[model samples]
Target: MRRRGGARRAPAAKEGGGAPSRPPAPPQREKLAVSTPFFAVIGLGAFSAWRGMFSLDTVRVLNAYAFLIAAPAMVLRVMSREPVAALWNGLFFAAMALLGVAVLACGILLFRRLAGLPFPTAVSRSQCLVGGNFTFLGVPLMLAFMGDRAAAPIVIALIVDTALIVPLSIGLIEAGRGGGSPWRIGLRLVRGTLVNPFMLSILGGLALSLSGLVLPEPVDRFLLFLGSSAAPVGIFALGIAAFLWARSGDLQWRIVMPLVAGKLILHPLLTWFVLAVLLRLDPLWVQAGVLYAAVPIAANVFIISERFETGSRPIAVAIVISTALAALTYPFAIWAISG
Candidate 1:
């Protein structure tokens, strides 16, 4: 019978005896490796803070650089190059918006009932728990670990969090405080959102992309240079901020522990379930969603807490503890999503 069809082509594995192809190291391990440098820079910042290398004024200057210059430049550069089509990842956007709203609502209700917090305080606490530091911590970590594929998704998530979740949460807090009228509060939020640096950069970039206009080579290079500084500087400032918070003697374990659990564990678990298990979006988007979800509470949350005369102390503690714990949780999140 033709020698039994040449022995079934000699089983490919036996044919070469090439040692089972060694199932390429667990993805989590690879992901952890990729994130090492980013974490190291952050650690360096913390170490510097511990050493008293950064004054409050110095930290403020660093924050200004990252927020006003580096971050906007980076966003502008990245958004300008992205295909207009990349902005319309409908499933990703829906998934993010759903997650944000669900988490915010549930968090508010839970904190209000379980903690017996006042309505305004409950709203502020919920905002702190859900509003991740995607602008500084998430963007830098993603760019460092995922490379260029991270740019567009990061921007999309930022938009959702910045334009939608943040403004909504803040508006609720303001309303709970019995602010002027609901309409006036909303109008103020709208105007402020429009003028925000992050929003401005996103709008400008989209406008450029829509117009099909390319920046001059030198101008583009300038943006690239400025944007490159954003990652390190922003993360470094965060490190210092964490250091300061830890020394403040304001961290109530009762409050900080629960908030940390919510942000570092609960939020990411929900995101993975929705994006990876349910929707089954592209792996990059899934990774992006999970990573951002796992990020620590935003510094802006503390600002919001202070502005509303809610408890900024608890918010600050949550930021420090959650970020510290993220070194472990983030890699696991990556592994879970990838696997």
Candidate 2:
């Protein structure tokens, strides 16, 4: 009788599967849903710019506000609240360093040998291969997808890009220019990195985290409020930038497409292999690394181009192309990673 009862119970459990529940939505779908609002705002901004509703000066002001004010606040809030030690993942750092070097080398070689770009121009463009729109787009996307778990990885990624990859790329750019010595280039990189608002915020947050000091309630609230404004404003600014570039004459698609392909596809593919396969890090780290890599070529690339007076149009066009294409590529990437 007992055996018969047990058999019946086992059959019942198997048939019902513990409890009735809806199959969870696909992770990729969930991410897309979260992303739609941000993209919508980007479209709105683009439309506005297309209609000539915003001037170039207005776009510049918006960019400044997002960069100097809103983004720094966001970074500080996240970095301050998290424990410093918990945020430092040695494996992630190593993966980032390896990936940066690989991307930089490959970009330079491809441009120099195949496209036959001048060496300095090639070096400047190579920075785009490693650089990403981490500040404006990446942070919002990460928060939407992974929540606070993303803070450490985001911090590490930014540090690698800003402090290491960007500096090295700029150093090479200077060296290629044939005037500045190695020591001068290194010093300038260090000084610029130190003064950057993003870096300053990171350092401030780190200090807060290390000291175990809670911010005063009012101050904390202020940071939170300002930080929350960053995503929409920054993304909108991106659209304005796209519109501005579109009106600036020839796009030079021949160069633009390759740079777009490198940013949206190659970087993420290599990052996944390194983090997910080679290092076998945690899934969150792997996802963060790849997705961040998959973000568009940064607006900063255009800034660098303008500063150096080289490749401005092509780089700007690549930025727009990569960003637009990311809407399709990013969902696919999420699906791949989840799978």
Candidate 3:
């Protein structure tokens, strides 16, 4: 009887002494919960790319809606509500932009010499390293994870990119061609920045914010409704775009790898160091800056490369790879910074 009783108690003790199997489930569940939204957006895009769901015309229409209507409305609403003071992070913006340019300049020179790339190819590839899909990918992702109120830094970064980095990219491309005069390039830069809908929306919003006048209830509500559509539409369109580009045949691995690495990894790492460690910026601002830095190469890089007649294929491949990979990297970035 004693032996039987001891055996019974031993089994109970073993059960009690073992780690609880249920405790780990919640954390895992929470992680999945956090990641679900991101994947849902990507999945939506992927679904749209499937046959019968979205055609090329459908993608174009969705992109136009997001760019011309939804995004601007969202930007206007957010910027109008945010204080003008919060939008002016000149030091941090300048530091981050200048650092990005410097890094890309070095990359251009290094690839030119070491890789023996032609000047136009080097310039195009370097632009891929520096530019990011901040508007479509970064903006929506920022609004999703950080909320609309936390988007001022991202807007500031967008302005800085348009104002400064873009000119540098164009200048480099033109210089490589030995074609456009410096004055002509400078004028084109100014025109391009001024004419950009994104920039215009930001400026208009800032003006409204600074004016201290509240938007009427109807207008405000309308803007809110329109702005709400930007994220889902933009992300879905991005997914379709990625799917189309990825099927565009073999990549120039030599050029694509370095440019993709620089855009997705090196730029964000350097931005984090400069903003988070050196400047000790607001934690929110640092996260936004780093997140923006980590976005995939912009599609415009291909446009620029094409205009200059160099490295367009490599740029397109880099954009496709970086955008696809960002689906994984973005979640990790949010987790790291949020934690």
lDDT-best of 1 and 3: 1
Q: Candidate 2's residue-wise lDDT over 1-339, tens digit each?
A: 011112111110111124223235446668667667776787888899999899768878998999999999999998877666556777788879888988898899989999898777897788788799888888888877767667788888878887888778777777888747888888898999999898999899888877767787798899999998988898898988887887784778777888888888889999998886777776667888987898888888888778877677788888888888887787777777777
lDDT of 3 by residue, 48-163 (tens): 68654776577678878987888889888877765565566667668777887798789889989998988877877887877888777777677656555355676777776777
lDDT of each: 0.78, 0.80, 0.73
How far out, in Å, is residue 308 in model 2? 0.4
lDDT of 1: 0.78
Q: For model 2, how many clashes?
A: 0
- Worst-scoring 10-residue span by lDDT in model 3: 7-16
Most lDDT-accurate candidate:
2
lDDT of 1 by residue, 86-126 (tens): 54566788889988998989989998899999888888888
Better of 2 and 3 by lDDT: 2
Provide the global lDDT of candidate 2 against the true structure.
0.80
Over 4 Å off in model 3, which ranges? 1-39, 50-58
TM-score of candidate 2 versus the correct structure, residues matched by position: 0.89
Global fold similarity of model 1 (TM-score)? 0.88
Top model by TM-score, which number? 2
